[model samples]
Structures are given as C-alpha cells and as structure tokens.
Target chain A: AQSVTQLDSQVPVFEEAPVELRCNYSSSVSVYLFWYVQYPNQGLQLLLKYLSGSTLVKGINGFEAEFNKSQTSFHLRKPSVHISDTAEYFCAVSVLLRRFGAGTRLTVKP
Target chain B: DVKVTQSSRYLVKRTGEKVFLECVQDMDHENMFWYRQDPGLGLRLIYFSYDVKMKEKGDIPEGYSVSREKKERFSLILESASTNQTSMYLCASSFFFGAIPGSGPEAFFGQGTRLTVV
Candidate 1:
C-alpha cells in the first residue's frame, strides 16, 4: 500500500508567479506518482505522471513535477501561473489500481 | 482521443430509491472504476470492474454495487440512496497493460455526475 501527504491544504499565489504544491508519499515497493487538476464542478484531468527514466516530467497547462526516490516527493511546480490556473490540485500515489492522497487546493490570484 | 461518458450529469433521487449510475468508455479499456467525492474526503473508490462480469470491491463499498455486462458499459447501483451517499460520482477508464505502457495512474476521467438525495 502507498500513502500520500500533500504538505499544504491551500496555497494562494499571485498570477504569473512561480508556485509549488508539495506532495510526499510512502511505499514499501516501487510506486507510481501522478498529479491531477480539477476545475470547479468538473472531474479530474491528468496533469503529469512520473513512471520511470526521467526524474522530471512535464504535462498539460504548463505544469511540471519531479520524482525523487530518496525524498519520496513529487511536487508540482509552474514558473508562471495564470488566473485560469486556479483550481484544486491532487497528488496521488498508487502501486496497483488503488490510490492514496489527501489532496491540495491551489488558488491562483490576480 | 479517449473519452469516458457518464449517464447523468446531475441526478436527484429519493432516500429509499435504488439509483443506478451508468458509465461507458469508447477507448475499449478493460478497467473501469467508480468513485465518490466529498468536500474533504476527496475521491473514494467505490467499486471497480476489470472485465465483463468481473467486479471488485474497493475501499468504501458499503452501500454500493456494480455491474459490467459488456465491455464498454459499467454501472453502479446504490442499494438504498441516503443523504450520505449524495456526492459527486466519478467514472474513469484506463487501458490495463495495453500498447500504452506505464499509464497506470493516468486514467481518463468522465465529467462526474453530482447526485443529490432527498
């Protein structure tokens, strides 16, 4: 089983500023990490995933995340954020089909 | 493009009614999942089906049951709708070990159906 802990419950950032949402996971075996974003009253959309090879991975909407084995962290970062980027972000970790995470809410301010 | 579709975007059901939530996937994925999202609880897996006529109980499968009669359709049934069961229900589909490798955590999600039990 894998568990995820999002460091921040809510993060408010100014538009065009760099933002980072921290997430850490605990697993005994090899794990897969993912970041998903959800708009108001909408379902989750995949932002990025860290499977293997590169430690750094990029995804849609100018979002990126780094996978650190030792640190067990897969934090999402964006150099410049927009007002439209304000949404609820979730960091999930899974070994099989099951997942674990408390989730984080990112609010981009203008 | 992979698309997952849920039957109703919003549903209103009586407390004792037997509610059925339908889902279909166009990508022919073998794995289908049903989840319910609450304010602070996030997404809790209610049920999952790996293949036709195959179903598995997830973490919180107390009042929910699922059926997969065909390859494309999966349905979730609420035995008895309660206020606690009123939440945003999400359906997702993924290719399990298909041509796409390592797509385990990137399941495509459908526009969740918000259920309100009266």
Candidate 2:
C-alpha cells in the first residue's frame, strides 16, 4: 500500500511572494505523482503530474513541481503568486491505486 | 475537452433514506470513480468500476455501493444516509482501458454534487 503525506495544512503568503507546498510518499513499487487544485465549491483540477523523465515538470498557470527522488518529495512552487492563486491544493500518489493527503490551503493575501 | 456530468449539483436527503448519486461521462472512458471531498480531508474514493458490471471498493466504501450497467453511467448508492455522508461528491473518468503496468491515467472531473444529509 502507498500513502501520501502533506506536511502543512495551511500556507499563508503575500501576493507576488514565492510559495511552496510540500508532499512526500512511500511505496514499494514505482508510483505516479499528481498535484490537484480546488477552487471554492469546485471539484479538483489537475495541476500537474510526474510520471517519468526530467525531474522538473511544468504545469498550467505557471506552476511547476520538482520530483526529488533522493528526498522522496514532490514540492510545488511558484515564484510570484497572485491573488487568484488562493485556493486549496492536494498532493496525491498513485501506484496500482490512488491515495491523497489531507490538503494544503493556500491563502494569498494582498 | 472531456465532459463528466453528475445528476445534481445539490441535494438534501434525510437520514436512513437511500440515496443515489448518478454520474455520466461522455468520453467513453473505461475507468469511472466516485469520491467525496470534505474540509481538511481531500478526495477519498468510495468506489470505482473498470468495466461494465465490474466494481471495486476503494478506501472508504463501507456504507456505499456502485453500479455500472452501462459504459457511460456509474451510480453510487448510499444504503442509509447519515450526517457523516454529507459532503461534496465528485465523479471522475479516465481512459484506462488496458491498465498496463506503468500506464498513468489522467482523470477528468465533474462539477461535483453537494449532498446534505439531514
């Protein structure tokens, strides 16, 4: 069985400031990594996914994540966050099945 | 664009009543999933179907059942609604026709149904 761990539940940052959401996973076999975003009252939208290849993968909305195999982490980062970026983010891991962490609430204050 | 539609956007049900949540996907995807979202907790899977008449229990499938009589429709049944079951239910579909060893399936989500159990 695989499990996803999201260390922080809430992250508060000012607009135009950089932000990072940490995620880690544990699994015996190879796994797939995904980041999903959820706006208020809305369903989950795929932010990005890392299946294989280059460690760094760029996703929509100028958001990107780096897959650090040695550290067992896939953290999401945005150099300059916007007010519109305020939302909830979830980190998930899928090996033969899927598992999700609690979630991180990003508050981009002006 | 992939389209997944739920039967209702909001619903209110009484405790001990049987509740049905319907979902349809137009992409003809082979994999359909039912999940519920709540504050703090992210999406937790209830059930999933890989093919017609085939179903598998997910992490939280204790009080729920599923039906997939057709390729496009998957239904989630709550045998007895409870206050704990009130949540935002989301349905997703993916083209995982042949679940290969390393195949990564990208899911498309529905708008979601906010179910309130009274």
Candidate 3:
C-alpha cells in the first residue's frame, strides 16, 4: 500500500509572500501526484496534476509543483500568495486509488 | 464542466438510525467513491465502485456500505449511524482509464455532506 506524508499541518504566511507546501509519498512503483484546494464551506478544486511530462508542472492561480523522482516528493509552490489563497490544501498520491495526506491549512495574513 | 453533486449539504440523524448519503455525477464517470473527512484525518475512503454493481472496500470501511446501481450514482449507507460517524462525507468520481485503475485521472469531488449523528 502507498501512503502520503505532508510535513506541515498548518502554514501561516503573509500576503504577497512565497509559500511551499511539502508532500512526500511512499510507493515502490511509479505514481501520479495531484494537489487540490478546498475553500471554506466549498468542495475541493484541482490545483494541479503531474501525470507524465516535464518535472515542473504549473497550475492555475500561479501555483506550481515539481515532481522530483529521486526525492519522492511533489511539493507545491507559489511565487506569491494572496488573501484568497487561504484554504486547506491536500496532496494526493494515485496508484490504484488516491490516498491523501492529513492536509495543510494555509493561512494568508493581510 | 464535470460536476459531482451530493444530495444534501447538511444532514442530521439519530443514533442507530439507518442513514443514506446520495451522490450523483453528471460527467458519466466510471468510478465513484465515498469518503469521510475529519478534523485531522484528511479524507478516508469508505467505499468505491468501479462499475455498476461492483464495489470495493476502502481504507475505512468498517461501518459503511455502498450501492451503485447506476454508473453516475453511488450511495453510501450507514447500517447503524453512530456519533463517531458524525463527520463530513464526500463523494467523488473519476474516469476509468486502461485496465489499471491507477491510470485513471484525478478525481472530481462533491461539495460534501455534513452529517451529524446524535
């Protein structure tokens, strides 16, 4: 079985600051990685996905993630964040089924 | 756009009562899943159905059951609702790719149903 570990449970960042949410997975075989964001009282939306291609995957809202095979990590990063970026971020590893991390609550202060 | 809709946004049921959480997807996805969300437990899969009438137990499937009579609809049934089951329930759907389910793409999630079992 595969599992995901999100190093941070909560991250607080000031507005317009850069942020990186770490995600690591344990899988013997190749895996697909994804990032999803859930706003307050809303369902989750796809932030980005790494299926097959370049290691650097850019997603909506100026967010990006790098799939480092050697490190077994797919960390989400954003050059700058805004107040609207405050939400719960989930990192998922897809093998036969998708397993998510505990979740990281990103708080963007004004 | 793909849309996964849960029947209820909020539901409250008494203990020991049989609870049914409905999910419907309009994208004609071949796979549907039921998951429970807790404060620290991101999302634990309860059950998932790959095709009509085929169900698979997920990580946490102790007190949960699922029914999928149709491709777009999947229902999660709580045989006996308990206070411990009071959590946000989410429904998701994904397209079935090649023979390997792992090839399937990212899942689309519903708004989630806040179930309060008291």
Lowest-scoring 10 consecutive residues by lDDT in candidate 1 chain B?
B97-106
Residue A32 displacement in candidate 1 (angstroms): 1.2
Q: Tell me the lDDT of model 2 at A61.
A: 92
> How is the predicted docking of candidate 1 categorized under the CAPRI scheme?
acceptable
- Name the runs in model 2 displaced over 4 angstroms: B97-104
Residue B5 in model 3: shift from native, Å? Answer: 0.6
Candidate 1 stretches with Cα past 4 Å from truth are B98-105
What fraction of correct interface contacts does each candidate retain?
0.37, 0.49, 0.67
Q: Show the colliding residue pairs in model 3.
A: none
Candidate order by TM-score, decreasing, is: 3, 2, 1
lDDT of 1 by residue, A5-88 (tens): 889889999999999999998899887788999999888899998877899999999999999999999999999999999889
Model 3 docking tier (incorrect/acceptable/medium/high)? medium
Q: Chain B of candidate 1 versus the native chain B: what TM-score? A: 0.93
| Per-candidate local distance difference test | 0.87, 0.89, 0.93
TM-score of chain A of 2: 0.98
Q: Which ten residues in a row have the lowest lDDT in candidate 3 chain A?
A: A37-46
